[model samples]
Target: MTASKDGSSRNTLQSELAPRDMTVTEEDVEPELSEFTTPVSPLPATERQESICAWIWDGCSMLEQQLKKKAIKTRFAEVLESEDAVLAAVTLPKFKLRWLRTQDRKDKAKASLLAECRKLVLDQDQQAGTSTSTPTCHQSRDSAIEDEFFSFEDEDDTSSTAESEVTDYFKSGAQEIDSLNGFALIKKISLRYNAATPSSAPVERLFSLGKLVITPKRNRLSDQKFEKLLVLRYNHWFNS
Candidate 1:
């Protein structure tokens, strides 16, 4: 049990709450305490769903703000298209099964991935005759080549006079949000994760070139033309 605190300053009492002290402390704490009861009555299933939907909206908003601060480089990308907020507008059924329960497995998978990535990076670096001078983010090219996983951010950077811009943004926004702690925590944790696939530009280009090759007006294209376009698209998509 956490200590009851002065809500304004949120300073906990140095002394334990004796019975007599409760009359002043507990009574004075009417509004905030009224909102937070230890034995909260269970809300109905529908009501609970509504509550969570609202929470997700706030979570998504916070995510957008954080991403803007990070300059994620693809703010208007189709896949990310305000989908976070939309998912939050309803009780997300998926998270209860997939994301929430898979952290341990994900962590294990990340470790394995990190190892493989290090080996691949180092092998390529050695072949090319280069090494890491410093590690950036969770892993860096040169350090891994020399068999070391290092982080770029120093102690001062981690906890400096100027906090991480993303951290400060969420700390300010999260309080206004309902039950967004998990979402915020996930974002912070995701900062260390940098596993990414190839560029979207090439993927888009392949699709563009494919569409051009197979004209929509041609309701029935010749087999040879279709095969040529398919092979060409795949070749460009992967070979790049």
Candidate 2:
């Protein structure tokens, strides 16, 4: 009876010490797996869209700054505002009629324009002279000649004829005026001032050609040779 009681007590102790049946089910494991695998919520949809748009706008602004650096300089507009520009404009037949009308009324602008033309003519004669000795005499004579030549008579018939001439000059396809004939000095001045390019595209194109020619393999080329290569590259289309 004593052994039987002792065995029963030992079995009871073992049962208490042993772990309980703890088989995991899908329901128990799912929440744990989801906790690790699920992604954190991102910014709200509208906020995310706004951030993308802001990024694109910043990129565009950067690109615009880069392009502005390549734009042509606009200093030519300042040159067009000078007294010499008036003389240059007058060489065009379209402007000649307005100039004549201004001269007849003795407008200050016309006076300033005529003075500039006279100055340019005198300067040309002085440059052409073999000797610069006694510049005062030559200057006085030239001034008198210019004054008489440039003087306009306020005749209705003269005005009518000038208006007709201007109309006819444009009707003839506005061909290039003869540089050696009427208003040669003024024409030369016009060409000099108006020959500036409106944009730097041609210069930038040349730079691109230079880049293509001066690659790493040809980096040792001399300056003269590089220039020649650029010229050839630019004119390759002409050959084609």
Candidate 3:
């Protein structure tokens, strides 16, 4: 009985000496996401709502602007749909008119001549007022009117001459065409056309496929066959 009592006391002493399990409590352990969670700026309820609304409105405004820009780019309006309008814009007749107006020999010459005619008329009118004889006054007034008419006729002649020169310049051969102002104008227009982005990843991938298809072995493939093959390769439903 004493041995059993002693064994029990020893077992209790060993158990008391054994390491206890250290349980983690809420206060003892830090939250795993405590470092990641950022403290939000404190704001009044109404002010926070207003800020959120403003952010949403800003996003909507940006989306609307993008949609409007896309519409303008893709929409075929009445002006753009007209073949005559397209031709006129490309040929740039209005541009030619503005260009001619800046020339030293054309517009400047006409302006100076017109100014001289006005001065002459003003001088003659003043002389007619001062003249003693009635017939002399009438003759001066008639001559001034004739001079004004002649000046306008001269301007028309100059304009027709300029148009002829411009026509002849455009009709000239390869050497002359290279030196033309119209070539430079077309170059500027081409740059604007080339700046447009009307393609995406799918189109780019199609081009890569084209390079593969147009190899030395398949270089003789007809345009129709090439197009059909490309369409079939890209569209799974078509092949199925």
Best by lDDT: 2
lDDT of 2 by residue, 107-220 (tens): 544455444445565565557653664445446877878876875652343444444433343344443555214444445555765566589888888887778898999979
lDDT of 3 by residue, 39-83 (tens): 776577779899999999999999999999779857856655454
Better of 1 and 3 by TM-score: 3
Name the runs in model 2 displaced over 4 angstroms. 1-85, 97-109, 128-176, 197-202, 205-240
**Model 1 TM-score?**
0.19
Clashes of each: 1, 0, 0
Count of backbone collisions in candidate 1: 1
**Candidate no. 3 TM-score:** 0.20
Best-to-worst TM-score order: 2, 3, 1
Model 1 per-residue lDDT tens digits across residues 1-240:
234435423433433333454346656788788788677456777798998999999999999998895675365354333433322321122332133235664354334333433444445545654454444598866767665334344333433312333234334423323433444333323333322445898667666777766776876988897878778767876689
Top TM-score prediction, candidate number: 2
Which regions of candidate 3 are displaced past 4 Å? 1-66, 73-76, 93-240
lDDT of 1 at 129: 49
Instruction: Provide the lowest-lDDT 10-residue window in model 3.
Output: 93-102
Q: Model 2 residue 80 lDDT?
A: 42
lDDT of 2 at 179: 29
